[model samples]
Target: MEWIKLIGILIILVGFIFKFDTIAVVIIAAFTTALVSGISITEFFTLLGEAFVKNRIVTIFLLTLPMIGISERFGLRQQAVILIEKMKGLTTGRFITLYALIRQLAGLFGIRLSAQPQFVRPIVNPMAQAAANARYGKISEADEEIIKAKSAANENFANFFAQNTFAASAGVLLISGTLTSLGYEVQATSIVLVALIIAGISFVLIAIDNFLFDLKMDRKYGKKSSKGGQKS
Candidate 1:
């Protein structure tokens, strides 16, 4: 039975690596392992149901996907582009960097700036596309998609990594809980202060990266303009 459980975990990892649908892979793996371990199909399904009920948060988020899909289909991207274009002096990297900071600030108040259909697809993506177009004159569809993905990743890294700095953050509570469980007394404030230092360093690094990217883009645009002047 233990071997069956191990096999199920292995199958799940392999399925993830092979890019299979996660829910399908997990369900199939669970049922197969249960059968191999001499558990009846009815028992296996009951276990699955119990697990689902225990993790109802995951289920609720899954159910929200359809509403998100509907919103995205209703010209959300177009609206974001229009909103961004009206803002003066916005560059793609700068725009995303600002969003990163805002997301981190929002996290301080326990508000999650989610990526999916919430902020990324509907808001940040189109804003990024508009910025790309403003900076480069035109952007390819592939490049637009890349910008959207990069913007989302920036938000995730910034918000998640930065929020650990707050002493009362969920990360602090988690760390404190784990330490207590393991018979170690740790101060949440100390952990949070160290996390703040780490987050500060990360912010500096991201800022430098954005600055370099902007410099490169400026050089590219300058060379293109110089060549165009020669042609004229």
Candidate 2:
């Protein structure tokens, strides 16, 4: 009977292995776990409601999506493309590296943003594509997708590694709390210093990656068209 309480884990594993609907699989696992744990259906719903209420702030990101959608509908992406096309001597790699640096700076300042929907998809990705198009005349579909992926990767790399540079950031606070609970004294400032070092390394690595990306693109595609012979 006790072993039956672990059924939820088995269910979740099977669902993931078989590629079932993710949300449904998770919900089913929760319900099954609650039932086996002797939680009544009413009690289960109550617990779910309580958990949702406690974590409702996590859903705040959803509110930004509609605003982003409205702006995109009104040619936000097109404006970004135009802006990038107008910039002389800005190559795709240089632009992406610059954006990653900006992302890290924003994180250091505790300026949280929905990078993918708000920045990358609407601004960065299109701008990178425009920079490529400006230099190459017209890039292949595959090349455009590669640029999109690199844009997203830059956002992720900078945001994840640099957030702790803010002494009051969640990662800094968590590290401090965990160390204190383990009978060790820790300072958020110390955590931030380490985070800064990690962030610097990440910036260097991303810059190198961008340089390699530019070289690869140059090799795969021909030199910049004579009309727009700008070095990346």
Candidate 3:
């Protein structure tokens, strides 16, 4: 029945509204569509296998997860703190702002290596704290949490707004593919181009906010000497 064609969408709406398991909802949606379209069971599985092989890139992040975990366990984060402590004139806000810029730039090329779970919390957040200590001499727990929270927000805003600019990015590809299949005939480049304004504005606004916060910190602690302190 033509009415059955709407079942996939209905399942999605209800599944999300009820907060059901997302993966199971997607599987059910696909089955509902196949069944309504009179697809034989054998053909449905064959098509599913072909689709999986075509887009196995979705599993690439899982391959890198274990190595990231191992690196953290072996003192990779401690090394980051030591390196950051050695850099003179790098304040808490300056370090976080620079990180956001680097992450945003990498997003243009579809690189997301500095994400929060694997990199920022373990590595970047600690580095920011080291820089703060170098500048302020000592910071309270509350102030440290403030810096870390800002660092996390910086990474999230920069990465979330900028990554869509990469035409070949997985998110962009998925969106464009969905639209194309629905007969919209849109190009990924157009989407990326439109997103550029949003990304650029976000980078500039967040950078300014960060540097201004550093000015506030400078007043809280005595301003640094012109020598930028001894290197290492």
Candidate 4:
């Protein structure tokens, strides 16, 4: 019986690895495991119901999908582009870097900052493109796409790396709890201070990376202009 349950779990893992529908895999695994364990269908369903009740927050967020979809249908991208175009003297890298900083700051307060359809697809991507065009006179299609991807990645990295700095952050709390459970006296503030030091280092590294990339692009553009002038 235990072996059957283990086999059911293995099947679910395999299904996931093969990119099968997650819901179907979960349902199949649950049914198979219940059958092997001699659990009646009604009891299995009751257990599932209890699990769902325990995770009601997840269901509430899933319910918000339709409202978010409706809002996206109403000129969200166009509005973002227009707003970005109004800002002068912004470069793609600078614009994205500023957003990254804002995202990190917001994470400290446990605000959920989404990238797709909210930050990246709607705002940051368009803003980065507009900034690129403003700086380079005319950005190519490929460069515009690159800017969008970079902006999204920047937001992800910034938010993930900075959250560790907050004393009450989920990661810090999780670590502190684990240590306490293991009979070790750990301070959340000490963990947070260490996380802050690491976050600061990460910020500096990201900034330096952006700066170097911008410098390289400027040099490449300067070379191209010089060549064009020589030809003229």
Candidate 5:
């Protein structure tokens, strides 16, 4: 019966596999685990409350979403498009590459951002589309989708690789603590240095990818525009 406590893991796995409501599944798993472990319902709620209180800071970031929504209602995306239009010579790929660099810098400084909602969807995607329009006149829906995907990818890659570059970042602290618990002497500073190096490498690789994408877009769109003009 003691092994029944492990049934919570099975419940969670099955729930996720079957696409159950995520919060309900997690709570059900926790309740079952507590019950099988001989913990009373009152005690379980007490533990849950304690854990929530201790980690409540994690939810603070969600507050920014409402503000972002309000801004979008006030023409935030349109303003981004207007701004991008005036920036001559800034191509879609180049703008996305620049955003990646900015995101990396923000991560290295421990500044948290909700990339997809706060920047990518509202700012980056529109600006990228505008830049493409400026250069190639108008782009296909497929190319717009490509810009959105690449913008989100840039944010993900920069944030994931560069966040640990901050000495006090969650990743650095978690790594150092785990290594120390495993009897290894690991310093957060050391992890930060390694993360910075990885960030630099990722930035270079992403830049190269953007350059290639620019070349592909040029071949597909730029030459077509020129040829159409010549025939006119």
Candidate 6:
């Protein structure tokens, strides 16, 4: 029975090697592990239900796939390019930094709009790329990939660090509950206060990183622009 537990790991390895659907493979592997550990099938369903309730927002995010597809099919990226081209003062770096600021502020207020794939990838990334293209003409494939990564990173840093600043946030509640269970007697207020300070520091650091990365891109573009001028 004990050795049978390893079968779940083997299943995952095989599934990955064969390039199977990752979500299906992982869920099946989890169920197999629970059953091998002597958990009843009914208990497994109960666990799944509880997890779904706790993270139903993520489920909703997944459901937005069709909506994203429809929007993109209707020239979502083209609209972003047009809008970004009209904004003279908004460079790629400034745009990402501004988004980070808004994301952190929204998280503090419990609004939580820092979704990368849904919001960033579809909308924000295209706009940032447009801004870069406006300034640099046409960038290399590698530079565009790096800019997208930086945009995603800014979203992640803002969302993760700022959400904890809310006293009644799920993260604070979970932390308080865990500490209570461990007999630590931690207060939610304390967690929120510390989280607030951390959020401030994170915003500053990420802003700096965005600024520096933008400078690097600027230098690259500057070189390209000078070379083009010399050729003309």
lDDT of each model, Cα atoms only? 0.74, 0.91, 0.86, 0.73, 0.89, 0.85
Q: List the residue pairs that clash in candidate 2.
A: none
Is 5 or 6 the stronger prediction by lDDT?
5
Q: Write candidate 5's Cα lDDT for 142-195 as tens digits.
A: 988898899899889988898888999888899999999999999999999899
Runs off by more than 4 Å, candidate 3: 1-69, 174-185, 224-232
Ranking by TM-score: 4, 2, 5, 6, 1, 3
Q: Compared with the true structure, what per-residue lDDT tens digits does model 2 show for residues 112-173?
A: 88899889988899999998887677788988888999999999999999999999888899
Model 6 lDDT, residue 55, Cα: 85
- lDDT-based ranking, best first? 2, 5, 3, 6, 1, 4
lDDT of 1 by residue, 146-183 (tens): 67677778877787677777778788899988998999
Taking all chains together, the TM-score of candidate 4 against the true structure is 0.80
Q: Model 1: residues >4 Å from true position, as ranges?
A: 1-25, 32-41, 140-149, 168-170, 178-184, 222-232
Candidate number achieving the greatest lDDT relative to the actual structure: 2
Candidate 4: worst-modelled 10 consecutive residues by lDDT: 223-232
My TM-score estimates for the predictions, one after another, are: 0.74, 0.79, 0.66, 0.80, 0.78, 0.75
lDDT of 4 by residue, 40-77 (tens): 99999999999999998876765556666676679766
Candidate 3 backbone collisions, by pair = none
Worst 10 residues of 6 by lDDT: 223-232
**Residue 113 in candidate 5 has what lDDT?**
81
Q: Which residues of candidate 6, in runs, are more than 4 Å off?
A: 1-58, 223-232
Give residue 15's lDDT in candidate 2 (0 to 100).
100
Give residue 39's lDDT in candidate 2 (0 to 100).
100
* Candidate number achieving the greatest TM-score relative to the actual structure: 4
